[model samples]
Target: MDDRKKNKEAEKVTITPSDESTSEKGHLFGLDETIESIKDAISDFESGKILNIAIIAPSYAGKSVLVDEIVNIYSHEVTKVSFSSIITDKEEIPLSEDQSKIMIFDNCHYLYMRKIGGFEVLHAFLNMVLEQDARLCISTWNIHSWNYLGRVLDIRKYFPVQIKIPPLNSSQMKEFLLSEYEDGEILFVNDVEAEDKQIFHVVKKPLAEKATHGRIKLYTLKVNYVALRSLLMNKGTPDETAESIIIKEITRISRGNPGVAKKLWKKWLEYPIIKTSNIDKFSPSINIDVDSRFILYLILSMGYIKKCELNNIMNWKCSVDDIRINMILFELLNQELIQINDEYYSIRADKLHLVTKYLEDCRLVW
Candidate 1:
């Protein structure tokens, strides 16, 4: 076997779709409203309303799962196809003949480009949708791709029914994450876990400060990140349960992303007995240059990427020089924003929030 294949496989996570939350089926715990909205939209489609739905969300926000659910619901009518990367042509996409039918294209971002003028397939698909009859098409897109396309092609105008998946609220996030566990089955350790507990009150420099702190007003109750986490956790409250508090903090940090929240919870639960105090303390902010951020985005979009494929991804994006990209990757490794085992690279489960937030602010992620 090749040395690359001989190396270990990347870590994996397993989720039970059937063990979904109370609100919605599957892992989409807090998306009852969205599901309802989608059903209503589909009903309109059935009525020949011809509503084209664009489900805009970030990676691992259950975009595929949501579409899959809708497909299962309308299996007799909807035809679904999934894409992973750039698609130059629409030859492979099957068009529906029935005017009242539904067509679903997941990862529809594959049709557009970030730079400019490279989306012939997207244009063709839009043309097909517009020129055709009363049939409805439902497509999913990365928030970043959708934003870029909005500016480039005004794509939102076409998707009259845009279902932007909002982050799950505290209650919804709690139910979603805890759905897998039986009542009080998981015992949590009631203490904050940190490498060093010493405090730092100094004003951070632009390098570190810019990434973590957005606004600053002197003596305006500037709170340290760790301290703020401590404050929001509702610690020592007789009424609040540790599990609820932990889920609240996780939802806050994860911004209601089910995948990120689940991964964070798994990482925190290093042992069978959950024993982590301040969940926020686990979130670490790391600074990165432009090249590094680009690399991080690629890995995140794909969720987990092969270590050997780093150069391929960088080149695909036409990123920095190979040597420089290697240097940035090494720096990322040093920062522990990502983990490498065998021949795969992945974002550290705890750092999902930090990474997602950074990309979101840049308007790069969904």
Candidate 2:
């Protein structure tokens, strides 16, 4: 594999012997509440509560890290199975034959198809988990796939205790990233104001009370109106420091995602110095057309894609209707929203959050 592929692989969550231990390496910021919740669920399960867990989080949100810790803690007691992204077959997930009463599945989303309402493997897996009383199952899924499945199958019903990991704040982000480096080794440059920001054109969406459950749906079309209004109208200009500005920018661009923030930090770091003046915020000017948007979501859903992969995904989605694949690819290439390396097209790490935000605004990130 190439260096790029190696780097991508490095970004993927993996299990190590140290992860199974109560070492400092397993420590994570802003996850105390989540860890407590998982412990409580485990306690309940031990008490014959049968509350299997669904650890739901967005892509690259450290779901695997958390799950690895859990499995490491219970390695001697439970059976563990991890699914890979390259998986295209829906084979039967094997059961443990060593009389283990608990099982843990990572990337349970891989069991299902990405198409709308396509849950053949997931449905089977859920049945297997729900039907058997001899085994207690803990599964994790991508937030997007979970939401889609919830809409179609009410997936929450299967797992009574659902743990939705919350995003970290600026302070948490600082402490988290700072753990990787020593004091005075890195500097943050802060900037003020929202003047001359790039404009992103999005399709105006209409929401009914039944559809959105609240009036906030009306505010979906206004991009960052809350933040922009606060910055321009309510907030006062004070003496800003480099650390504060860097944290804010990191929080904004990464959307409080740990993985994305780590990648951004690596890119921004210039040996021993980082300046906000040099940090260019990439606020993408999104063109929210349906076909292009759908294609982006499908690609994001899977880490990387080939033409054949998209065809398989569209097969389940029934979305290959009157759309020119070549034209869309060309347009995306021109826009630089995605990058193609050796015929395998993938999103650039720097633009991950921009693409995610665009898809989220389109309600495709869910």
Q: TM-scores for all candidates?
A: 0.72, 0.75
Count of backbone clashes, every candidate in sequence:
3, 2
Worst 10 residues of 1 by lDDT: 6-15
Error of 2 at 328 (Å): 3.8
Colliding pairs, model 1: 191-277, 192-277, 192-278
TM-score of model number 2: 0.75
Candidate 2 lDDT over residue span 108-221, tens digit each: 766766765556767767877888686677788777778877987899999888998788899999989888688877866444344423233344455776767755444344
Candidate 2 lDDT (Cα, 0 to 1) = 0.69
Q: Which of the numbered candidates is closest to the native, going by highest TM-score? A: 2
Highest lDDT against the true fold, candidate: 2
Per-residue accuracy of model 1 over 1-366 as CA lDDT, tens digit each: 111232123111112232331123556566668879999998887777877889988655777667756765666666655654455456744454443367777777766544345577788888887875666788888776677678768998889999988898888877777788888777866564343232344443343466647454333223356545555554565455556667777887787888778887887775546654535454556678777887887666544455445565444444446567668778988987887755567677667667878887776664
lDDT (0 to 1) per candidate: 0.66, 0.69
